[model samples]
Target: MEKIKLLLTQYQEAILYIVFGGLTMLVNIIAFWLAFQAWHMNSSVSYLFAWFWSIFFAYLTNRTWVFHSTAHDLKTVINEIFQFLVARIATAVIGFVIFYFGVNLLKQDAQIWNIIQNIFVIISNFALSKLVIFKKKA
Candidate 1:
């Protein structure tokens, strides 16, 4: 029990990130399914819908819980939000490329390709958030 607690404490940020990231992925997947499967939207359009919702959810959870951001001032807050969005946009472009290649070019399943792209997005997003957006202040 003590060992588990220690480990949890040590990796609290990563643990919380995974938890929130999973929820974000769920939001993206569900949105994509509804748009693509139910509403019969184009795969590209559906991906955009999923990306918007997931990005919104991710920003909120990452700021409040995962990174525990402390940007109190208006300027700092704006800067943080800008940086976060930029980082997400960068990763989103990568996801779109992967999705386009897998689903459009190679004729793979849209759902599977979306999931694969998202895995990459999640990993890259974590790196950006930790190393750049949410880095500890010197």
Candidate 2:
């Protein structure tokens, strides 16, 4: 128990972030698949829907647990959400570009492209959250 506690104390933020990020990815992929395959939605539209859901989930988890944001007041909460959205939007553009090139231009499979895009987004998002969106205020 003591060893586990010590390990968690040492790497709580990272471990939680990874676990939540993975959940977010799962949400995105499942949503995308449902919209694209089951619902027969347009590819880009499905991707957008998945993006919206995943971002919302990510924000909730990140604010509540991963970064432990202390946005008590309305202004601070709005600012933090704005920052988080901006960072996510930046990554969204990257993902979209990759999807566009891989699917439309190269005629690659959507599933394969989505997997690749998520891999990049996950890595980039962790950096963005740590360095910019969720950086502890000095």
Candidate 3:
């Protein structure tokens, strides 16, 4: 975390966000791929498997490394966690629904839908984390 804070002065935190986001996306992709290819699960099940992994890792990384804040009390931690979960879960539901209708039902490319949803979710997650959970330093 200290190293991350030092890097923030020399590098854009967006780079860190992207790196973490990319790794977290890998978790999602692998989880979803396994659920679908191995178990032949439904789209929702595959999405949930991936989404849960992404959400958990994002929270862990953002709280411990990215924000680098140590002021969190138990109450604040719980509140931030609740908010983060709501934001990610809502995005997941929205992504799945849009993907279903736009890609699956319409027979369009699923990758396109997934990319679109990921973009939206990424922006939302950044704003929420920066503003609410791991707010900017004074």
Candidate 4:
């Protein structure tokens, strides 16, 4: 129990991030599924809708819980948000390219491709947040 507690203490942020990441993925997947399957939207359009909503959800959770950002001032908060959005946009572009190749060009399953893309996005986002966006102030 002590060892388990130590482990949790050491990696609490990561564990929390993973939990929230799963929720973010759920949001993304559900939005995509609803847009594409239920509403019969174009795949690209559906992906955009999912991306927008997921980014919003991810930003809220990541800023508040995952990274515990303390930027309370208007300028700092704006800067933090801008940086986060930039990183997310970069990942989104990568995801879009991967999805295009996997689903449109190679004729793979959208669901499967989306899952794979999200795995990459989650890892990249974590690294970006930890290293760049929400790094601890020295």
- Candidates in order, TM-scores: namely 0.74, 0.72, 0.68, 0.76
Candidate 4 lDDT, 7-116, residue by residue in tens = 99899889989999889889999999999999999999999999889888988899999889988999988898899899988997898899889999999999999988
Against the reference, the lDDT scores of all candidates come to 0.92, 0.89, 0.80, 0.91
Q: Model 2 lDDT vs. the true structure? A: 0.89
97-132 in candidate 2: lDDT tens per residue?
A: 998899999999999999899788778888888777
- Candidate 3 residue-wise lDDT, 98-125, digit = tens: 7888787889898998888878778877
| Candidate 2 Cα RMSD after full superposition onto the native fold (Å) | 3.8
Which window of 10 residues has the lowest lDDT sum in candidate 3?
Answer: 8-17
Model 4: runs farther than 4 Å from truth? 38-40, 94-120
lDDT of 1 by residue, 1-138 (tens): 999999999999889999998899899999999999999999999999998998889888998998988888999988988999999888889999999999989998999999999899888989899888888888
Worst 10 residues of 1 by lDDT: 129-138
TM-score rank order: 4, 1, 2, 3
Q: What number of clashing residue pairs does each candidate have, in the order they appear?
A: 0, 0, 0, 0
**Which prediction has the highest lDDT against the true structure?**
1
Residue 125 of model 1 has an lDDT of 86
How well does model 4 score by local distance difference test?
Answer: 0.91
Better of 1 and 3 by TM-score: 1
Error in Å for residue 122 of model 1 = 3.2
